[model samples]
Target chain A: MRFQLTEDQTALRRATRDLLERRFGERERRAAAGGGSLDRALWRTLGDAGFFALCLPERDGGVGLGFPEAVLVFEEAGRALLTGPLIATLRAAGEVPGAASGETVVAAADGWTVEWLAAADVARPDTADAVAVRSVDPLTPLHRVARAARVDPVAVLLTAAEQLGTAVRVCELAVQHARTREQFGRPIGAFQAVQHLCAGLLVRAETARAAVYAAAVTGARTDIAAARLLADEAAVDGARDCLQVHGGMGFTWESEVHLHLKRAWVRAGRGGGGAAAEEALAAALTA
Target chain B: MDLSHTPEDEEFRARLRAWLATALPVLPPPPDPADWPARRARDLGWQRALYDAGYGELHWDASPTTRLIFLEETEAAGAPYVGANFVGLLHAGPTIAAEGTDGQRRRWLPPILRGEEVWCQGFSEPGAGSDLASLRTRARRDGDHYVVDGSKIWTSHAEVADWCELLVRTDPDAPRHRGISWLAMPMDAPGVTVRPLRTLAGSAEFAEVFLDGVRIPVANRVGAENDGWRVTMVTLSFERGTAFVGEVVACRRVLRELAAAARRDGRWDDAVLRRRLGRLNAEFLALWRLTQWNVSEAAAGGGVPGVGGSVFKLRYSHARQDLYDAAADVLGPGALDLDSPWVLDRLSSLSYTIAAGTSQIQRTIVAERMLGLPRGR
Candidate 1:
């Protein structure tokens, strides 16, 4: 009956938040947005810390936890705007052989060609002892040289989880901005228009969180699509609001908020878009 | 994480189902607005049969666990739940149990539990729907009774209800939300009239209840004078809790029906339709979990989670509307024709968003109470 996070989940979240703070701080996030890809050392650090391995069964050398725990981890990741092949790495960790041990990165190689992959140092093409990367989230460092399999709905759910994290992060940034940024001798958060926007962002974040958590618990494919739809909206909209709250700063490369928006836009297209997700949900509801 | 019930509970459910199967015939789905009276009568009969089987008093203190079992069983069976005078049983009954005199409980509880009395809430007037404290209903003490004069709208089941759990201003000079008294007023009293009002769905499920110089016995008073605001809040909490669980389950059934229809029409192949169904399915699942959390929390004697009810209500209502809109969009031309039974189902879903409370009000509640945001000007 308890909705609050368990001790293990709290530890996992705190550890993840601390690691993200140390590895992908505001300066590092700004650096990544400028040109660099996700730091591989940090990726390995998360793997070692068991963030990617949390969802796997205990028999698989993983900490068998539940969706609620996963939610806390992803939410913290979102707060840090820590970008990488998070969805691919997490999914691969659970199902893909040796992927959980940080040996491979799985990606979906459909709808886009896999040519020059970024962050190829930690992962490369055509080396048997090398990384087996699938070309998914091409914008991220998830590309392994192995032949990619067809994308599954599970991948959609993972992506949705990541998006949920990103949305919440953007929401936090927006709230912080509203509280600090001033206009007309008062914080902008005091203004009705700004307050309404922040309120709306909160609503979207909560709704999306509800959807994603439900999907994770039920392990239903339809629920995954639903979560994706909500997460997609939340991320895109939350980032938009973040930019709005930051005014011109949010529009520039110096601000990491737009990076979340871009990444979310790309992820929203992955698996499927709003139209496909909505159709599936509508059918399930009516059926 | 374990949602399953004990074997004893399962046995209780079996007995309830067996009893209901014998005592009541399976009712047809709710009919058109033109056939509402017949539908209402049939529903009332079903409720009576349930009461006879002791299923209607699930929330009553007679057997709290058994009452919970009743709700669980009714929900699992996909049965049309006890619908008549829901406000009475869920809100008024609890309020009386908590604050009413011993005589009040002894006299009122029996009729309410026996299906011998029907009750509607008289809190909202024409000008006092969301801002309920502004209600002008007056209940002046006269002898051993109170002379009540005011009107209450959006009173569901009022036409058939025997009484109303009403809130009235007992002291006009006191501050708003203060000096109010809660009373149990009989509907058939000297100056009471019920006029059915048709909703957008075309059903006259609610009524405008007019009370002019209606006399309520002093014994019928719930709580102390000028303490009605707190009493009303207690009642409203029930409205937001147990009563809401049944409604959410009912909405789930509708969503399931929509899913089935989509599958039947080969709409699953359409990406647009699939996405819509998927989203609705997800939202419904979330609402379902939220309900489970609410029930389990209450059962464990924990306070209701902050604004979680508002979250549930808002999501449920919005998802319901979205489900119907998607149904109509998928049905296309077929939806425009009321002659089609599917169209009627779609029409019924429209009321889900507006009924009980509007989506906007639910959001306001969530914002003001749950989020601790200042009220909108």
Candidate 2:
């Protein structure tokens, strides 16, 4: 009846965090986003490290892991706010020729929008003339894509895992800010208002993390739907509360808080979004 | 992360289920809410049956997974819960097992497992609810006895309890938190009074216990003098940690029944309500999974839940409230009827945010203890 990470899984998670912290810290993330294009070198580096090919068979020139491991890596990527066609490329690892090696950057259409479409080497359901759109999140470049489809459940679950990661990251950011940021001669964390907000954020993130991890394990459609719904809430709401904790500093472009908020907003719309997930869940329950 | 039960655990579950199937039908019906003595007898009888069947002591003696299975299977089978014996079995007994002396264990633990005694919590006072450390219930030491003279509010089952796990300020001069002591007060002692306190739900299941110098033996002290606060925290950890396992299962059952009622009443056709129910279904499912995560985490780390229990409690308290709110939606005007069990549950749900620990306190604990946030004065 264990529901915690095994020693091996914990080591995998730590390694992923270390890699992201070293290669995709705030400075590097902003640097890669400055030109509004995918960083090819970093993408290749991640692929070489088996971030994309984590679930692929060792016989097929890949790391032979599973969804649980993939979820952990993506969670780290989400925390680092690593942007690009990461989810699509990872999904295409085994099927697309160069995706597993990061030689090809794949982008998939999500409703009317697609991320990094211009920088992608291949588009899954080739769109008819994508127009570049100004993205709310600086790290993620988007284009107005003309096609959309009901995404696979695995894609939905992975999107949720990313949201869970963002949720967790923002919670830590909120707690850190609350502890160090002072107001009226004491840490703002000493105040109940800010403390309650930070506490609620942790609760939401943790609840969503449980749902996301369980979705990865169970692979049930209902579980995935619930995970997506909760993860979206956690990420979106957690970022907003984190900004509240940081006060004026959080609103500045230099602070990473806004990036998390924008990314959460963007991710909330991905993989059929909250409305779709809710409807799926509603149908399941009603049926 | 494996969630499957071992074959041995599965056998235990199967045996329990079979025993319950045969055992439940022959038992007398449950007593009314107002019938304290009858309720006590019925509850203790169920406990005794479990004791005789070798399923007693599972709360502390069994592995966490097995305990979880016991809770899940029992709740699923519509079996009687610990009921009036909750404080003794879930709270005091565990505290005693964890912290009591060998003699304390020998004297107290078996009677609790055998369902021969009942205990009520005497922690909350009229002057000290959330700020329990500030309780002014005084206990003065004399020769071999402590003369307790104070009052405790919200002491559940005090009217029928054989014992009361009482907290009193033993040293008025020391720091508020440091001056306390935990003592097991005999409820039948002279100068003790129990005044039934009616809840908002119109039930007098709890009482205001006033002790006008009730004498307790020195041997009844669970832990050292001036260390009651820490001892009380131990009991509270149990309250927050695994106390809600069976309740989570019960909530899931209530959710299913609400959905079925909604369908019967044509409330299922409403998209908004259906979506709400669906969302709640997802919420409870996640909470159940959260319970699994917590229980497993506890099992891995010395069988005591860490701060994660606060996280579970915070969300779960609201979820339980939200669940009853959804039931009201299904019931519509039918919800106004006090006779409905759903209506009664909706009323009972109001206390969850206030009981065990308030949601406000839970947030503070999560922030200060779990997140390492600076504590507020």
Candidate 3:
């Protein structure tokens, strides 16, 4: 009945948070946004740290933990807004050479689009003839493709995991902003409108976190589908709300709040769009 | 991270499930919330059967997990759960268990468990619903008996209850919250009258109990004379616990039903309808997860359910209402027709928004209590 993370999981989260805070501070995050492709060195660092190997078997040169541990790490990665083809490489663990080691970078391509293809040493192509295309997120580039295969469920779940992270991160960002940013005379959080918004954001994040964690633990398709749906809603809507909390300052390019919204927008479309997840969920509910 | 119960829990669940499978068929279904006498008769019989088998409030020392399993399995099996004795079992019983003397416990606990007596709550009054401590229900100590004079409104099952967990303004001069006292008053005593009050859904599950100088024994006072507010809080905690597990289990089934109905009505193809259903379910799962986290947190700290009560209650109540609202939305014009099965559920579920505490009050609690926001002007 216990839902609290084990000591190992909590430590893993703390380590992941510390690493990203050290590596991708506000300065590095701004620098890494050159053409929306993550820095190769940072990508290498993630790979070398066994981030991709978390769920892969130990014999296959992976950490051999499981989805729960993987989710815990992914949540932190999400919180830090560390962007890259993390989900793709993690999915390709044990199957693709150098994926678990970060020696080779992996890019993802659906039928018409690919992410991080220009920098990728290897590509998990949903298409055979993938042509790189521009993506909405400047932090992650996209590529067009000729043909593509169905996305893996694990990859989909990982996207959800990332979305869950962003959802939680944006919630904290909003609350932090609300608590500190004064308006009219007091902290905006002291105002009912701002307080209610923060409350709503908290609700969205917690609800999505609950679903995502449960899905990560069970790996049930229905749970994952629901998780993906809620996490996307939470991340996207949460980002928008966070932006609103930040006011005109949040709308400016200098503010990191907009980056979270852009990131949420990208993650929401990845793995599979809302339509794909919705179909599975509707079937499960109707069945 | 394991959500599933232990082997021992599974065994309890299994035995309870087996018992329910056999016992439920023997007892008739509850008539309706409004039909107090008939529903109570059946609920009492069913409860006594469960109590005889060492179920119900008889298992006072059961772990939180075990209690949850019992609730989950009972809902899944559609077994009767002594709904007729809700106040007696869930609130009054728990309050007495926590605050009563040894002799008082011996006298009250067994009858509640055995279903020989039903209990009603006499807390809210005409002028004091949410601001319950401002209650004017006066109870004057008159030579070993307290003469109660004010009326209690929204008292559930007052007509059928043999006793009431009464809150009275024992000391009007004291501060509002500090002046109240908790009493176990005999409902059949002289000068006591019950008038049924039907809700918008046409169910008389509540009553306005008029207490005109009804005498209560001095020994029946729970805690001290002016400490009734604290005792009343214990009863409300039990009321809050009532929402923890059953609603999740039941709402899941309702979601499934709504989905099936949507499909049958050819509304499943509508993307908007599908998304609405999906979103409802996602929130429902969130509510379920939140409940689990709350339960586990309580278990870990050996604390009664605290924190996130308002948040959890507010979210889950709306989710329940949204479920029915969506069902009706998918059903269209038929949703308005009384003949349609969805209509009653849709119409009846609005109570969720208002019952226990209104959503606004819940928000205030969340704002002031959980979020640490200052109290409103």
lDDT (Cα, tens digit) per residue for candidate 3, span B172-235? 9998989999999998899999999987766676899999989999999989879998887777
CAPRI category for model 1? acceptable
Off by over 4 Å in 1: A1-4, A55-60, A64-68, A91-117, A120-149, A175-196, A241-256, A272-287, B1-41, B52-54, B59-78, B255-271, B297-306, B342-357
Error of 1 at B230 (Å): 2.0
Candidate 2 lDDT for residue A109: 81
For residue A49, what is the lDDT in candidate 2?
Answer: 91
Off by over 4 Å in 2: A129-132, A145-147
Residue B344, model 2: lDDT of 89
* Candidate 1 chain B lDDT trough over 10 residues, lowest sum: B60-69
Against the reference, the lDDT scores of all candidates come to 0.69, 0.88, 0.79
> Which prediction has more favorable DockQ, 2 or 3?
2
**Tens-digit lDDT string for candidate 1 (A54-96):** 7899998988877667767776776666776565567667567
- What is the lDDT for B309 in model 2? 88
TM-score of model 3 (CA atoms): 0.93
Rank the candidate models, highest DockQ first.
Answer: 2, 3, 1
Best by lDDT: 2
